[model samples]
Target chain A: MHDAVLRIAGLRTQFRTRQGTVDAVSDVSFDVRRGETVALVGESGSGKSVTALSVLQLLESTGSIADGSIVFDGRELVGLSEKEMRDVRGREISMIFQDPSTCLDPVFTIEDQLVEALTIHGTARSDARGRALELLRMVRMPDPETRLNAYPHELSGGQRQRAMIATALALDPQLIIADEPTTALDVTVQAQILDLIRTLQAETGAAVLFVTHDLGVVAEIADRVVVMYAGRVVEQGSVFQVLKDPRNPYTAALLASMPGAVAGTGQRLTPIEGVVPSLLDMPSGCRFAPRCPHAWDRCHEADPPLAAFDLNRESRCWLEVDGAVDGVGTAEVVG
Target chain B: MTTVAEQPDAGPTGGTVDGPVLEVEHLTKHFPIRTGLLQRTVGHVRAVDDVSFHIDRGETLALVGESGCGKTTTGRVVLRLIDPTSGTVRFDGQDLAEVDADELRGLRQRMQIIFQDPYSSLDPRMSTADIVGEGLAIHGMASGQAQLDRVTDLLEKVGLSARDLRKFPHQFSGGQRQRIGVARALATNPELIICDEAVSALDVSVQAQVLNLLKDLQTELGISYLFITHDLNVVRYIADRVAVMYLGQIVELAETEQLFTDPRHPYTRSLLSSVPIIDPELARATVRTPLEGDVPSPSSPPSGCRFHNRCPQAVERCRHYAPVLVDLNDGRQARECPEYRPEPFGLTAQSYRESELLNQGTEAGE
Candidate 1:
C-alpha cells in the first residue's frame, strides 16, 4: 500500500463576500503521496491557491470549508479548532508562501526567526541557534553566518527565498505546501530554487504540494499534476500523460496557448476565446463551455464527472466519455 | 540633420536614409547614488552601459535579460523617457538627443511606449475614450468626430468595442486593459513602439491573444517594435532578432532561431538551459549547465566580464580582460567570452524534435 501524506476528497471552500457566497473551490479531490511532488496547476481565480490554504486550514475568517474531508497522516483536519490546528501546522505540515519578500517577518533576523520556529516546535532552547545554522547551510545559503544575522530585507530575492525554504524545513515537517514559490524570481534563480527544492525533497523524503500556474515549472518538478479550472478539478494524471496527450479540451488549450520553442515563428496560438466565468454568476452547465472548442450539446446540459481511463489518470470532459481518445490518435496519423 | 551638430559624432542613425528604423549606439545611463544627507554623489549605478542595438523597418527586435539587467532601462532610454548620460538614439535617420523642443514634440508622434503592467499603466480615473484619443488630440492628428472615429478604429483594431469607450480602466479585465494600452500606443500611428514586457503580465491564453493582435497590427500598419521582455518563449514567437543583456551590457545578439538552436555566449547558453521545457519527459532527461550565484550589483559590477562570477567555464582571462561584442558569421554575434566553447547544453535536437512532434500530435487532435 502506498503511503499517502494527504488525501482530500469533495472539498468545498467558500467565501462570504459582499456580492454573494463565492465558491472558490468546489468538488476537488486529490492526494499527495509520501516522497512525491504533486503540482496543483491553474490560472487566476482557478482556486488552486485556495485549495492549498484549505489543506492547511489557513483560510481567512471570511472563508470556510463547507464540505468534504482533508485527512492528513491518518488524522482528520476539518472542524479542528484554531488552537488545535495550530499544533498540527508547522509541526507536521509547513507552508512556503508565494512572495518571499513579505512571507518572512521584516523586523526579525533570519537567525531569530528560524530559532523561534525550532524552539516553538519543542526543540530545546539552547540548541535552537545551532539548529538554525544547520538549516541555513542545508539550503545552501552562501555565507550562512552573515545571512543569519541579516534581516529579510538585507537579502536578495533568491537568497530570501532560500531562507524561506530553510525555515519551512526547520521542523522537518512531513509535508510542505508551497504556493508559487519561484514565480516572483528570475528564470535563472527560479531554476536554482526548483533544483534546491527537489534535492531537499529527496534528502528529506517529504511530500510536496506545489501550487503554480506555469506549466513549465510543473513539468520540471511535479510527478503528478492536478489541473484546476474555476474551482473544479478538470484533469488529474501523471505529468507525461497530461502534457503529451491531454484528454480535456481546456488542458489542451492551455498547452497550446503557451509559447514554446516548438511553435517557433509564424504560428497562430490557439487561444481559448472567453474569460473565466465569475464564481457569483457561473455558467449553467460547464463553466468552460463557452471557451471550449469541442464543447457540444451534451456539455451544455451538465458538468462532467472526473472519469478515470487509466491508473492515476482522470479527465472531466464529455469528449472523453464519448471515446474521443481513438479519434485523437487517428487525427495525429492523418497529420 | 540639425540634431547631428550637438552630438559631434553624428552616430549611425544620422543622415543614413536606408538605415534601420531605430539605431542605438554606445548607450550608457548611470544613476548616481546620493548619500550622507548632503546628497553628494557617492557612486554610480550603471543601469545601462554601452548598450547598442537596432530595429529594422517593420521588424521586432527583442531585448531579453533577467531583472535588473538593464533591458527595461534601455527601452526607456531609446524612447528618451529617461535621459541617457551618454549615447546616441537615432530614429528614422535623425538624432533624437539633439532635436529642438518643437522638433522633439514632432518626433514623439513617431515613437510610442507600451508598459508591462496593464493595471497601473492605464489611469483608473480616465475613460478609455480619453486614454486612447489623448495622443491623437495632443499630436493634432485628428480632432472632433475624426479623433473619435480614429479612437474607435484603433479600439476595434485591438479587439475592443466602441461601447467600451466610456468605461474606465477599472471596469476592464487585465487583457482588455492591455488592449486599451495597445490602442493608446497606436493612437499616434507610430513607426516604432517600445514594448517593455508588454505581454508578461497577462495570462497564457490572454498573452496569446495580445501577441496575435500585436503580430496582426504589425502586418497591417508596418510598425516596428522594440519588444523587451524576459520570457524567451514569447521572444521565440514574436521577435525576428534578439539581444541578450547581462548586468548592463549586451552579451549576445542573433537571429531568433540561431540564438535558440546555438547560443555561443556562456550567459545565453545558461539562460536557455535554465528555461523549464514544457515537455516533462524532455525536461527530466536533460542535464542543465547550472549557473552559480546571483547577479552582481550593477553599481559594483565585477571586473572584466560581469558574468564571469557565475560562468562555469570562466578562465583566468575572463576575470581580467573585458571582452567586446564581436560579430560572428551568418548574422549572429556574441561578446567574446574567450573561455567559452559551444558545448551543447540541455534539450538536444532529438529531444526537441520529439517534444515538437508531441505538441503537433496535440494540435492534430484539434
Candidate 2:
C-alpha cells in the first residue's frame, strides 16, 4: 500500500446537548494515501461532516474529540495545544467548506483574505501578494487581477467558491479537506470547480479527504470511499467495489435509492423504509438494523464489528460475520 | 419571428373549450429597480421575460434552470400569486385576469402551491390538523368532526397517521414535515399543484420516499404538477415534459426521454453533460463540454441570445439576433440558434456504454 498521508483510527466525536451528550461520530477509521482522493460519503445525520470537522479540530464549542488518534505526517494531533495546532493548520493542512458565502468575510477583499492566509503562516508580506495572485490564477479564477480587489458578495457563487479554493491552496498544504465544496454551486459551475480541483491536486500531488452526501459527486472525484451510516463506517473499499458491488446492506440500499440509478421512468425507487435513528435514543444493536432490509434476528441483537471481507475492503454486517454473503446478494436482488 | 398575436390561442376564450389545465402565453414579469431619493424606476430585472408553456390534465411539465433563472417567478405568476407585467394565464377555460375578486377566490380552490423548505412553509405553532384543514375552513367545505376526519384521511394518504394530528411542525423530521406540507396542498382537492423544488431539501432516501409519494398521488388523484426545480435527475424521474429555462426565457421544451437522449440546444446539451453520472467508469469516460462563464446578470442581460456569452457553440451571428423557440414538429421545441444540430448519441448512450463496461468488470470479478 502507498504511504498514508493521514491516518485516523477509532475516532469518537461527541457533542453536549441540553439533554445529554451524543456521539456524532464513533469508532471511525480511515486513511488517505499520498496523492489520492478518499471520500467520506453519507446522508445528513450520518456524521460525515462531523468526522471532517473533528480532523481539523474545528468542531463547535459544544463538541470535542472524546477519543481517537489523528496522525498526520507522522505527528499526533488529538491533544495538540491551540497554538501548536494553529501552526499545523494552514501550513500542513487546509480545509474548504460547502458555503463560500459564509466562509469568506464579507468585509475583506479576495486579495486580503488570500494574503492573510499566507502572512499568518509566516510568509513575508512582500512575497504574499504575488503568491496570492498566482494562487488565484492557478484556481482558474476569471480576471484574477480584477477579482483580487472584489469582495465576497461581488463574486458569483462559483467565483466565490474559486476564491475560497484559492485561499485554501495559498500555502500549498500537504492535505486538503473539502466538505461538499461543490454542493452549493450550480451544476455547470460545479463541473468547472471539480475539474479545477482535480487538475490542481494532480499538479500539487496532495492527498484529499472529500466529504459529501452525493454519490454522483463521489463517483466523479474519489478513488476510495468510506460509507457512513448514523455515526459509524459501515463500509470501506475502492470506488468500484463499494459502488458497483456493495457488500454492506446500507451502501447497497443507498445506491438503489438514487433516482439516476434506475434505467427508465415510472420505476419506483427502492427507498429505505425508515428514518435514521435519533442520536438521543439510538438502537442497541446495529445502527441501521431498523431500516436494513437484509437484517436478521442476530442483526437486531448484536452489534456487528467492521470486518474485512476482501483485500482492502471492510463491511460492518452480521452477514459478513456469519459467512452469509448470500444475504447481501438477496438484498441486492430486492433492491 | 412569430409574435404573440401570430401564435395560436391555446387559452380558453369561449364556452366548453377543451384545453390544458393551465396555459400561460407571453408571460413577462419584470421587477423595477428604484434608485436614490426619488425612488424612480431606473431599470427592470426581467425575471420572467416572455415565457410560455402549458400543463395538461394529469401531466407534469417541469420548469428547470439554475438559480436566478426565474423558474420560481414563473410558478408564482402561473398561480397569479404575483401578477404578470404582461400576457395572460388561463385556467380551466377562464382567463385569470378577466375574473373578478369573488370569481378568482372561487377559482383558487382548484389550484395550490407547495414550497421547498418545509420548516418555513408550515406555520410552526399550528398543529397538523389545523394546518391541513386550513383550506377546508377557508373554502367552507368542512367543519368540526368532518374536518378532522378529512385531515386524518389526508394524513394517511401522505404516509402519516392520525396520531400526528396533534403535533406541531417542529415535532416532525424534515421528511415528515414535507409530508404534512403535501397533505395541506392536497387538502383543497386541487387539480393543479405548483411544487417549487418540493423534494430538494430532503436526504436521498427521504427524497426517494417523497418522490414516490408524489408519483403515486398523481396516479391516484390525476393531478397536474408544474414541478419547478434545477435537479435534472429528479426531473427525469417525475416530469413527462420539461422546459429548460435560461435567463428569463424557455430555451428548450421536449419530452423527458427525448430531451435526455437527443438534446437539440447547445445550452441543454451542456447542462445535461454537467450532471455527474453515478457510475464511476461512466463519469470518468464522459468528456464534458462545460459552459465557461457565469450566467449574465438578469437586469443587464447580454444582447441577442441570453446564453450566447457562455455558449460553447456561439457564432458571430448569435451576437446580433435574438433566438426564438422553434417547434420541431415532434412535440419538441428548441431555441433557434445557428449551431442547433441533432446528435445521434448523447449522454444516455455514453451511460449505456459505461454500464456495459461495468457488467464486464462484474463478470471478471466473479
Candidate 3:
C-alpha cells in the first residue's frame, strides 16, 4: 500500500485545433500506488479520459501532451518514442475500454483474440492457449470451455466486459486503467464486475486508475477521487472528503445534480448554469466560474492554480483554504 | 390496436360524482401470435392485463417500470392511442370503450399524448410553428392571425423564445426538442395529457429544469398527467401515486411517499433498493437485494403471481392461486399480496401485523 508505483506532476494536455490551442488538462498531478484504486471523475469532456490517455501516451494523434513528468518505477515516460511506448503498453501498463464488443474484433472468436494477444506479447501457441483458458476462468465466465470457442457477439454485455478484463490482465500489467467499465451492464452485473476488479487489485497489488461519472460505482470501489470540471481539476481528495464534504462548487453541483439528492430539496437546481464552453474558446478566469455560484468579481481576472492544502485535499479555486495564508496570488483562471 | 367495445355494460361512463377526467376499468390488451402462416392464435402477449386506475380532475398518476413491462402500452391504451381488447375506458363520464369512432375522434381533441422520443415523435420537415399549430389546423381551432397568436402563446408557455418558432427540431438541442413536444401536447388544451418518458433523453441539469417546468404548468393549467418512466429516482419525486409494474401487471400501487418508505410488494422493494443514492456512505446503507437472471419474456410470463419466479417471496400460494388487489391494513392501501388481508373479518393494521411473518430476501447473502 505504501509503494508509489506511478507519480504524475504538473501534467498539462492540450489540443491544437484549427481555431486555437485549447488546454484540456492544466497542471494536474496525482498518484496511483500499489493495490489502490484512484478514480478520475467528472461530466463528459472533463479531461478524465484525456488524463488516463496522456499517462499512456495514447492520446489521439491530433491531441498531445504539452507538459508533465510521468514517473513510473522512477523512470520518465514523456520523452519515450512510439516504439518504446508500444512495448510498455499492454505489457506493463494496460487499458480496458468502456465497450469490449467494439474493441473485440467481430471476425475473431474469444480463443483467437486471447491466443493472439498472448503470442504477440512473446508466448508460445500452446502456452498462450493454456494461459488464455486460465484468464477466462479467472474472470469467472460461465462455461469457459464453450465460451472460448464462442465469438464476442455470442456473449452478453457482462460476459464481454469480463473478456476485456481478461485481456487487460493477460500480461500481468502493473497498472490497469478502466474507463467506465460497468456503465453498459445492469446493477447486479455491475456489482459483480466491480467485485472482480477489487479482487484482482488485491491479488496482484496492481495500481488502478478508474474513470467514471457514476458516483455510486466510485463509492463502491474508489479509495480517492479526483474531480474534474471542464478541462481542469477542480477538486482532489479522499473518497470520504470529496463525496461528503466537497469544497469545490463544481463538485458540489455534481453531487447535488444526482437524482433523489436530499440536499437539493426545494432549491431550483442552479445546475452549472450554462453549457460547457467550447474547448476552442474558453473563459479568462476559472473555467467553472461562469457556472459556479461562489464565483466573485475577482474570479474573472485570472486563472487559479491548484492551491496547496494543509491536508491531502487540493483544489484549483479562488476559495481561501484555512482562511488566512495565501501562498499564491489570485492568478489567471483557465478560460 | 382495437376498436372501443359496444355498450350496455359500459359502467363508469354513467357520470356519477361529476365524472373522473380519465378512468380505466379492467382494461386488458392481448396481442396474438402464431406459428408458420396458418394464422392460429397459439398464445398472447398480455401487455396490459386487467389494469384499472383513474386520474382525478387535476392529479398526476405516474406509471413506472423497467423495459417491456407494458407501461408504455398501458399509457397508449388510456389515451385511446391504441384500443384495448377488453375493459372499459370512461373519460369525462363518456364511455370511450363503448363510444363510436366519430365520437372518439372528437373526444381525442380533449385528450392528447406527448410521446417518449422527441426526435421521432415530431415531423422533421415541419418548423416549430408548423408543429405547434398543426393541432389548430386539424381540429379547426383557429386560422391565420389567430392561429399564429395561439402558437406563439404556446411557445412562450413552454419557455421557448418567439424566434424558435421558425426553427426545425434539428436546430434545437434535446431539452429544447422536448419542450416543443410539450408545446404540441398543450396545443389542444387537453385536460388529460400522457407524458411518456418526457424528460428521459435530457441531461441531469436539463431534466431538473424540465421537471420544474412540468410542475409549473400543472399549477397554471389544471391538467391531469399519466406520466410513464423507467427512472425510479424521478418517480420518487414527481409521482403522487406510483404503480410499480412487473410482467404486465401492477404489483404495488400506493401513495408515492408510502410506497417508497414502506413497500409491500417484494418487486417494489428490490427495485427501490437497486437505485444508487448519491452520498457514498448512504449509498451503502440501503439493504441491497440484487435480482438475478434475465427478466422473463412478457409473452411467457410466470403464472399466478407474475413476479413469483423472480420474486423473493415465492410461497405455495404464489405458485397456485393468483393474488387480488385487495384492501390492506391501511385504509386507502391496496396490494396484490395474499397474506395482506386474509378472510374472517375487518382486519385492522394491528391484527394483520401480529399474523404476517417477516421475510428475509430470497437469495443467499441478500
Candidate 4:
C-alpha cells in the first residue's frame, strides 16, 4: 500500500453541553493512503462526521479533541496553533460539505470563490484565475466561461457540486474530506459527481476521506471501508471484503437493510431494529449490541477491540474472536 | 380492463379495484410568474404539463424523477391539495375536480399525504398524541378516551410505543419523527396516500424499516400509494409500478420489474444506468450512458421533447416534434415520437445497429 497521507489514532472528541461533557468520537482510528479513497460509513450520531471535523480541528468552541493524534504528511495536526492550522487547512487539506448552496457565498460569483481559495493559499492573483479555470474545466463544468461569472444560485445542484469540487481542488490539496458530497444530489448527478471525484483522485493522486451514510456510493468509490457505530469503529477492511462479507453484525445488518438495485422487487429488506443511542448516554459495552442479532452476554459486558479477522480485515465484535467460546453453544467464533 | 388479480405480486398484496383507485388524466398545473407593482401574470411556470397516471387500490405507483420534474405537483393535484389549472382527478369513482366543499372535506379523509421532512411537517409544539389524532378530531370521528385510544393504536402501528404519545416532536429522532408522520397520515384511514419523498431524508436502515412499514400497511389496510421520490432504489423496492418523469412530464411507465430490466425510454435508460450499484464489481463492469446537462427549467421547457436537449439519443425528429406516450404491446410504455421509436433493447436506431453486430459476434462465439 502507498504511504498514509492522513492517519488518525485514538481520536476522542468531547463537547461541553449543558447536560455534561459528551464524547462524540471515542477511540476511532483510520488511515487514508495516497491516491486511495477511504469511506467513513455510518448512520447519524455514529461520530463519522465528528471524526472528520476533529482531523481538521474545526470543531466548535464547546467541542475539543480530548485525546489522540492526527498525523498529516508527517506532522501532528492536533496541537497546531490556529494560525498554523489555517495554513494547513486549504493548502494541504480541503473539506467539502453536503450542501453546496450553504457553503458557497451567495453574493460572489463562482470565479470569486475559486480565486479566493487559490489566493488565500498565497497563489499569485494573476495566476489564480487561470488555475481556477483549469480546475473548473477538469471538473467538467459546462460553459466554463459563462459559468465562472454566474452566482452559485444560478447553477443547478449538480453544477454547483461540480463547482464545489473544483474549489476543493483549486490548491491541489493532498487530502480531501468530502462529507456526504453527493447526498443532496439526484442519483444520476450523484453518479457523475462520484465519477468526477474518482477521476480527480487518480489525476491529482490525492487521498480522499469520503464520509457518507449511503452504502451504494461507498461500493462505487472507496478502496477501503470503515464502519462506525455510536462513536467507535466497528469494522474496517477493503471495500469488497467489508461490503460483500461484513464481519461485524452492525455492518451485516446495515448491508442487509439497504435495498440493493438488483434485489427482486418482492425482496424484504432486513431492518436493524432500534435507533442509534444518544452519545451522552451510550451503552456500557458494544454500542451496537442492543441491535445486533448475534449479540450475546460477552458483547454487552465489554467493548470489543478492532481485532484482526483476516489478512487485511478488522472487526470489533465478540463473534470475531477466533477459537474463543461464545455465550451461545460451542460454535467457533469467526468474523 | 386491468383487473386486481393480474397485478405483480411484490412488496404488498391485496385485491385492487376494477380499474384504478386514483386516475389523473391530462393533468397540468401552472404557477403564474408575475411582475411589476400590479403583479400582472406574465407567463406560466408549467410545473406539471399534460401529465397522467393512475394508482390502483393496494398498489404502489411511484413517480420517480429529478427535482424539477413536477412529480410532487402531480401528487398534490391528485389529492386536490392544490387546484390544478386543468385535468381530471377521479378518486374512488368521484371526480375530485367536480366535488363540492363538504364532499372535498370528506374526500380528504380518504387521501392523505406524508411529506419528506418529518420535523417541519409536524407541529413541534403539539404532543405526539395531538399530532397523530389531529385528523380524527378534524373529521369528528372520535373524542375523549376513544380518540386517545385511536392515537395510541396508530402510534404503535408505526413502531412507536404508547409512552411516546406524551412527548413532543422535538424529543424524537429523524426516524421516529417519520414514523410519527406515518401515524398521522394513517389516522384518517385513507385509501390512497401520497408519499412525497417520505423516506428520502432517512438513513438506509431507518429507511428500510419505514418502507417495510408502508408495505405492511398496504397489505393490511389495502391502501394505495402515489410514491413520489428521486431515489430509484427506493422506487424499485417499494413501487409496484414505476413512472419516469422528466421536465414536468412522465416519459415512461411500466411494471417495476419490466421498467428496471428493460427500460424503453432513452431518458429512463440513462437514469437507470446512472444509479450507483452497491456491488463494486457490477458498478465497475456496467457501461454508463450519461445524460448531458441538468434538467431544463420547467418555466421554459425545451421546444419539442423536454429531454431532447440532454438526451444522448436525440435526433432531428425528437428535436422538432413532441412525443406522446405510446404503448409497446407489452405492459411497458414510453413517450417517443413515432418516427424515432426506441428499438426492443431501448437503444437508438444508430446504436441498435452497433448492438446487433456485437450480438452477432457473441452468438457466433456461443
Top-scoring candidate (lDDT): 2
Which pairs clash inside model 1? none
Q: Pick by DockQ: which candidate is best?
A: 4
| Candidate 3 per-residue lDDT over residues B223-295, each given as its tens digit | 7889898777677667678888777887777888788778887778877776666666766554666654435
What tier of docking accuracy does candidate 1 attain? acceptable
Cα lDDT tens digits for candidate 1, B41-87: 99999999999888898899999999889999898888888899998
Q: Model 2: per-residue lDDT, tens digit, B1-366?
A: 112222121221122445788889999999999999999999999999999888898899999999889999999998889999999999987899999998887778778999999999999989999999998788777778878888888899999999999999999999999999999988877878899999999999999999999998999887889999999988988999999999899999999989988998888999999998888877888888877767778898888777767776554455567778888788898887655431212223334233222112121100
Off by over 4 Å in 3: A1-27, A53-100, A105-119, A122-156, A187-200, A263-272, A321-335, B1-18, B29-47, B80-88, B95-105, B113-125, B315-324, B331-366
- Count of clashing pairs, candidate 3: 10
Q: Which 10 consecutive positions of candidate 1 chain A have the poorest summed lDDT?
A: A326-335
Q: How close is candidate 4 to the true structure, as a TM-score?
A: 0.92
Q: Between the candidate structures 1 and 3, which one is better when assessed by DockQ?
A: 1
DockQ leaderboard ranking: 4, 2, 1, 3
Model 4 chain A worst lDDT window (10 residues):
A326-335
Please give each candidate's TM-score: 0.92, 0.93, 0.82, 0.92
TM-score of chain B of 2: 0.88
Instruction: Record all residue pairs in model 4 with backbone atoms less than 3 Å apart, i.e. clashing.
Output: none
True contacts kept of 2: 0.64
Clashing pairs in 2: none
B11: Cα error in model 1, Å: 27
In candidate 2, position B347 carries an lDDT of: 24
Better of 2 and 3 by DockQ: 2
